[model samples]
Target: MQFCDECGSMMKADGDRMVCTNEACAASSERDSDLEDQFVTTESQSDDDVIESTEDANFEGKPKSTDVVCDECGTQEAWYTLKQTASADEPPTRFFKCTECGHRWREYN
Candidate 1:
């Protein structure tokens, strides 16, 4: 969080010292060991942190099942969604994901 005194630019940690980010000024200073210790990096996430899984995480979104065959695995079932990708006058795009192989494809309407 330290700034260069010469050119008023942010200083970054360079080994055991702090160096100015500005190439023109190129100011360097000794970093305080105590301050460095206080600013030491720590893990942000813990084992106790619980993360909820999204429906898309496992391709579990409500499937608009169709007879479309998968090009990768020849699977007949898939999850489909319509997305508005074009202008107002144009139709929405159809996106499909194969349930068995997770292969995705898009069709413009």
Candidate 2:
């Protein structure tokens, strides 16, 4: 990632150029091709992969009772956990799995 020359903040890609994310600075520059090659991209997980990973992380081994209503099977019982998905100041996201149909969903507080 390139740093903004004006504000010294990390610049983000905007089409063929890099733009400063800081609203106060709002500076933009051409994106270097060599730097683009060094940019890291996160590998997306498939549905099966995500499900397998979640199942493997079932520390309690049993579904916990929750008041969340499942969208798939309209079940009222679910297993829930808090996952940190954003910055430290932001609230942890809630992930839920329906006990009846195994449907998964996320709720942001």
Candidate 3:
């Protein structure tokens, strides 16, 4: 909302001074503190704000394998899980649960 006093054209803020847009009357002047087109500012937000949280996903599904046979029920399919029961250089131990009789067994590696 600032106007060039010399050219009577619109004035734009450029750093600390205001420049006229008119090509014929290229006038430049210092910025006014009580000008209409002063730098815009916003108020700081309050600290009291609501925070949101999310629930953990359900990771309870067990993987099934047809290769692992159940000893108690003689089933061909069973759910197996691996655990690091030995040293870091060795392989992990596999725990198997029968799908038919719900029998559990562990195999060390």
Candidate 4:
């Protein structure tokens, strides 16, 4: 018997596997299937992916865009976040809302 690391629930060892009694434990086989991106390192991934990851740290509290001229109302700037997709085939997008007019736009990465 073993205890679950996440919920501290009891688990029973069956053959080669240990299952928690909580019945909510995630199977290890499904963990990798939920990966948003397969690339692990910038040196080995595509240029776009590398650039996206580099910008992630700056997304925390950074302005939407540098010298970004709002096409709708000529606003000065806005705030944004680093939005990532499940894969490279997925769209690269970011939210940009006008601080003055509240007009939002999705800037694709």
Candidate 5:
């Protein structure tokens, strides 16, 4: 990951140069030829298959299940959790996340 020297914003690859992602920062620098762009990908899984997951730092330790489907991607597996968004007497909201495409949804009991 590269950062802009002028505004300290994150930089993305643009051909052989590292261009700043910040719209306001026009800073750019030459990229190393040896530094190849890395892209991690995963194979799709069936609805009744194993719970798919990633090694992303933020995704670590999150509980997952296959009880829901994503409206955007139609994946049948997802990571799930619950939260109390309403009054104490009310039921907690059940949130769901698509394991395939990272889509989020919620359910009220």
Candidate 6:
């Protein structure tokens, strides 16, 4: 008897394929093809492709998303405060505050 890789349950061979009795286990097997498709990377054929990838990785021409809008004046301006700092045991984090209305919010990684 073959075993189900997902659930470790016994699988019955049916002609050319084996089947899992558990519904969740069966669903997981079906997802492998989808996962494989996502991870398939196409190779770049020219130098222009390398330059474009480098620019993207360096965040060139990218607009900053750190600014918070002022609710009262509809202005695209705000203030920020750092709530956490990097240490031997922890990582750095930041939070923002609206300068006009004192609205506070936390930034996520």
How many clashes (backbone N, Cα, C below 3 Å) per candidate?
0, 0, 0, 2, 0, 0
Model 3 lowest lDDT segment of ten: 50-59
Cα displacement (angstroms), candidate 5, residue 43, comes to: 42
Candidate numbers, best lDDT first, in rank order: 2, 1, 5, 3, 4, 6
User: Which is better, 5 or 6, measured by TM-score?
Assistant: 5
lDDT of 3 by residue, 3-83 (tens): 788979987767778888898898999887776345542223452332211122121256777887787878998777676
Cα deviation at 92, candidate 2, in Å, is 0.4
lDDT of 3 at 34: 76
Give the Å shift of residue 94 in candidate 5: 1.6
Tens digit per residue, CA lDDT, model 1, 1-109: 6789999998888877889999999999999887865563324336333221234544456455776888999998887766677898999776787888888776776
**Which whole-number lDDT from 0 to 100 does residue 23 have in model 3?**
80
**Which one wins by lDDT: 4 or 5?**
5
Candidate 4 residue lDDT tens string, 1-109: 3456767886554434555667777432112233326424324546443322332233334456655666688887866645665487787677666655656666665
Which candidate achieves the best lDDT against the true structure?
2
Give the local distance difference test score of model 3: 0.68
Query: Which stretches of candidate 6 lie above 4 Å from their native place?
Result: 1-66, 70-74, 85-91
Q: Which stretches of candidate 1 lie over 4 Å from their true place?
A: 1-58
CA RMSD, predictions in order: 9.9, 8.5, 22.6, 11.8, 11.9, 15.4
- In the range 55-107, model 5's lDDT, one tens digit per residue, is 33233246777777789998888777666789999998766777788777788
Candidate 4 — which pairs collide? 36-86, 92-109
How does candidate 1 fare on TM-score?
0.44
After superposition of all CA atoms, the RMSD between model 4 and the true structure is 11.8
Write down the TM-score of every candidate. 0.44, 0.44, 0.43, 0.36, 0.43, 0.27
Which parts of model 2 are misplaced by more than 4 Å? 1-65
What's the residue-level lDDT of 46 in candidate 1?
65
Q: Report the lDDT tens digits of candidate 2 across residue range 58-94.
A: 5244447667899999989888777678999999887
- Give candidate 5 misplaced runs (Cα > 4 Å): 1-60
